[model samples]
Target: MFVSQPQYEFPFPPDLEQPGSQHWRMVELTLHAPWFLLTVEIFDAEMLDCSMSRTICIAWDYDLAEVLRGLDPETVLGIVCMMPAWASPNGQWSSKEVREVWMCSSPAGQSVLLVDPAGEEFDCGLVPEHVEPLKKDLVLRVAPAKPRRRPHSRRKTPPTGNRRSRRASARKSEA
Candidate 1:
């Protein structure tokens, strides 16, 4: 049996100076060939407080099949929330607080589950539009079976002779 490791791609914006201010709003996952693209929309709470909602789109890539197969009901598959850290009076950013709310596959593989840092679990109900295709693909596609090796068969070996000499002898006989 062959199993592939999941590859992830998370591209943060170049201008993101304050990593602690961003908070995730919504997450969308779509399958693009061998890659599962997770799109997360985040807004800065500080910007929202100033009457401006600045939303940014961040993406992550993963192998969803591998992820699902390896997931334990108690294990977190991925994180969705980003905690904020305020700057100190010296204009230096304080140590960022890491509060993560994670998503995982259910034990039955029929639905997704969410777990917060506090150990509270939530049921993810009603498949979203972005994930509908992925769910359908998983349902419709059959699991891959291990490749089988064919039985060995005996065969006659080729004559032991140099190719050039054999060809010359054959040419003389023909002439």
Candidate 2:
């Protein structure tokens, strides 16, 4: 797959919900990527080598990370998902695994557990006190090779008036 888009909803068990609560939040993952990275192993906390794609390890929540760094690692939640690959009607492409990863990657509010790979997956049932702030805008930018060019190239030539400018300048200088 060229890129992957994963939208995940963390499954909450029966015990996790409050008495009146409708559901418990397991996790949510939404990803829009260009191409798939081909690996899943982790060498550093900053990146991951997945079987089908290379992904940088990053936490998108700056507010959440700071809070996590101070609390107990075990108290935090971990979301781990794995999927295959798929294609769409438009030229856009993606992987099923990427979608699984998205569940672990997306968090809308604060107090979330997110990182590259501190030690193990969230399944370890442990969390750090405070995670590093997310503004920490952990983003990956790729250059588009063939940006959709305009059907009609519009060559904008500067308004031609150099001679007029010279005359104006000369008149001002004389004055």
TM-score to true structure, per model: 0.19, 0.17
Clashing pairs in 1: none
Q: Which lDDT tens digits does candidate 2 get at residues 91-125?
A: 44432221111112313323332223333223112
Writing each residue's lDDT as its tens digit, candidate 1 over 6-120 gives 2332445758646654323333334211112212223356684232212222222123333433433122212332211221335532322112222333333444333334555
Runs off by more than 4 Å, candidate 1? 1-78, 81-109, 127-175
- Backbone clashes under 3 angstroms, per model: 0, 44
lDDT of 2: 0.28
Query: Distance from true position, residue 24, model 1, in Å?
Result: 19
